[model samples]
Target chain A: METAFTPFTSFGGGLAIGLGAVLLMLGLGRIFGATGIMSGAVFITSRAELSWRLALIAGMVLAPVTLFFVTGQMPVLNVPVSPTMIVIGGVIVGLGASLGSGCTSGHGVCGLSRLSVRSLVAVPTFMVTAAITVFIIRHVFGA
Target chain B: MKLFYALITGLVFGIGISLSGMMDPAKVLNFFDLAGTWDPSLAFVMGGALIVTFVGYRLVWRRDAPLFEARFRIPTGTAIDRNLVGGSALFGIGWGIAGFCPGAAIPALGTGRWEVALFLLAVTAGFYLRRLLAPMQTARAAS
Candidate 1:
């Protein structure tokens, strides 16, 4: 399948994420880690922690409603993989992100932004492995 | 007030992912498929966000404390041990297989897909199971 090269839109989107992450740091002195936010939303018992996480999740879920108002259409998403593959992948991601203590937003964006040595190691290792996995699936197995 | 900031932050992030088209698993997968259909949009997204986040973080850190919080609650761990590398490798494999990072999936929940819901549920299960196994891994590390 041919992919669209969306330089402008992607860059614009990056700016928005940067702004969002910066806002979190400036206002709450927190790193905007999505997985952490998600898991905490489910597991953390602190009243304050839960409140903010729920609020953030609500915003995320409601964002498309806002998009509908402005763009007159909701953003469409495509899941190319089968449901079983999606479930298996999701389970693996959970184990991995939990063990690693972060995911893309955490390590890739927040940690790398801070220039943390640990994250510096993390970013490349994951990238190469991701590339290799794709190679295996696409070229080797020919999926 | 803190909750409000978090809500806005999430909204911004949701908007970013939507506009960047990261919510579309096929688009993300195409980025990994270098030989078949290479999309450089993801690179631009990362590069653009990095520029802003790198500079923005520097500025944010100049303050003694955040606007609402007394101190930053960032991670303190610096270890680059087995868990770090191994966990990241697993996460990368999962990402390559499905093209859905937690960062993208959380926001995509707005799209109301059954696949997203099921994947998220599986992830939650994986997280708890990993947490349960944490002590064993730590004991192994110590021994």
Candidate 2:
């Protein structure tokens, strides 16, 4: 599929994300980090703590499905990697997100917004590395 | 109340991710492809989110505590260690390779695509594996 820059959609979606994050912080007193929430839902020892996490995941899983009903179209997805590459990428992402303590949502949006110093350092590191990796794969290897 | 709040937050977030075009791997890849056909839409998404959260957090922090929680569950780690840097680098490479970060990946499952299912499985495995390895790492350090 051909790529296009969508400023309005991006901005609108961003506004929703920001509103969601703010609501989470104010209502639940928690950072809206996907990996952290997922991990907690799956691995937490206490069942009480698990309820909200599961609710969050359930809501996320339902959102696009709801959108499909409302708009009569499935959300656009463009996974361009091979099976092997996808597995490798997914594993690395899971491990890295866990080890790094946050992903784009936690570090990039919420953490940065909170003015966390660690997130300040992390965002640039990942962004630059991601840029270089894309350059290597797209230009150098020509994959 | 907290569960309801979490559900709403997740719903908003999922919608935002879908609308922002972040769910599209091609768009995400284009964002990373600075030297190629770079699309800056994700920047606007991030910018919009940052502005809202930046202001919203300050307003929320003024409160003594959240409505449903005792206190905020904020990360307190301040040190910049090898784990943070290395993990972030790994995440960046994975993101560059697959164009699916945690935030995008979860909601992508709503698309019911095989590739997304595979990626989700790998991500779950990666999270569990990290948990499995954490104890060993701590033991090795103690030894």
Candidate 3:
């Protein structure tokens, strides 16, 4: 797959993400953890709140879609792995996020900003583990 | 007023990160191409993030509590115990291999990447696994 980078585009994406985190934190009195949002949708009881959650999730899922359609510049996939491996990876990440009580957004962005210790630990843990795993896959196993 | 400001701040953060392109998977993947053609774009992203965070923290630190909340909610513990280390290791491995953390993964799905779907599933599984194993791990440690 071909890949390139542009400063303006990168800046736009970051701005949206940061703004989303801030908005979620301020309005709902909650952290914008992806896993948490999924969990809330799965478990919450109220219909009104459920709609808002659904809307939030929808926004996240659609934002890139809109970008792709409008720009005709589909985001390239950098991963080189089988569907099965990808699925396996997803399951593992899901479990980890739940165990950690938040995903990157909740902890990495909101939690870290709030200076939550759990997030501080979790963010670096996420970063380091991911780095080592990449090393092994790309170098050691040659996968 | 505090809550209002918090909401506005949240929006700014969310929009800001998105605009910065930090949410884009391909852009982030460029950071990992170190051995071949390493993309230095992420360094810029990090630089921007650090500056934002540094300034943001400095300003926020003055207040006893966050604008919308009762307390700042900073973590009290400073221990780098087993839980922190182990959890981080797992997270790093996943991210290194996949090149997508939870924050970026969700937006990636908007681009119709099957791999993003797979990674998200793994993340979910990891969360549950941690929950299931936590008690046992704790019990074993006690003994």
Whichever of 2 and 3 has more lDDT, that candidate is 2
Worst 10-residue stretch by lDDT in candidate 1 chain A?
A59-68
TM-score of chain A of each: 0.94, 0.95, 0.85
- Native contacts present in each candidate (fraction): 0.70, 0.78, 0.39
Docking class of 2: medium
Q: Candidate 1 at B61: error in angstroms?
A: 1.5
Candidate 3 Cα deviation (angstroms), residue B58? 8.6
Cα lDDT tens digits for candidate 1, B1-143: 87887888889888887788777888888888887778878887777777888898889989999988899888888899877888888888888887888888878888887877877887887799788998998898899
Candidate lDDT scores, in order, read 0.83, 0.86, 0.59
Query: Which ranges of candidate 3 are over 4 A from the true structure?
Result: A42-52, A68-73, B1-27, B46-81, B141-143
Candidate 1 residue spans exceeding 4 A from truth = none
The predicted structure with the larger lDDT, 1 or 3, is: 1
The number of the candidate with the highest DockQ is: 2
By lDDT, the best candidate is 2
TM-score (chain B) of candidate 2: 0.92
User: What ordering of candidates by TM-score runs from best to worst?
Assistant: 1, 2, 3
Score residue A92 of candidate 3 by CA lDDT: 59
Clashing pairs in 1: none
- Per-prediction backbone clash count: 0, 0, 75
| Residue A24, model 2, lDDT | 86
lDDT of 3 by residue, B77-143 (tens): 5566666556555555555555666666766667676777777767766666766797998899999
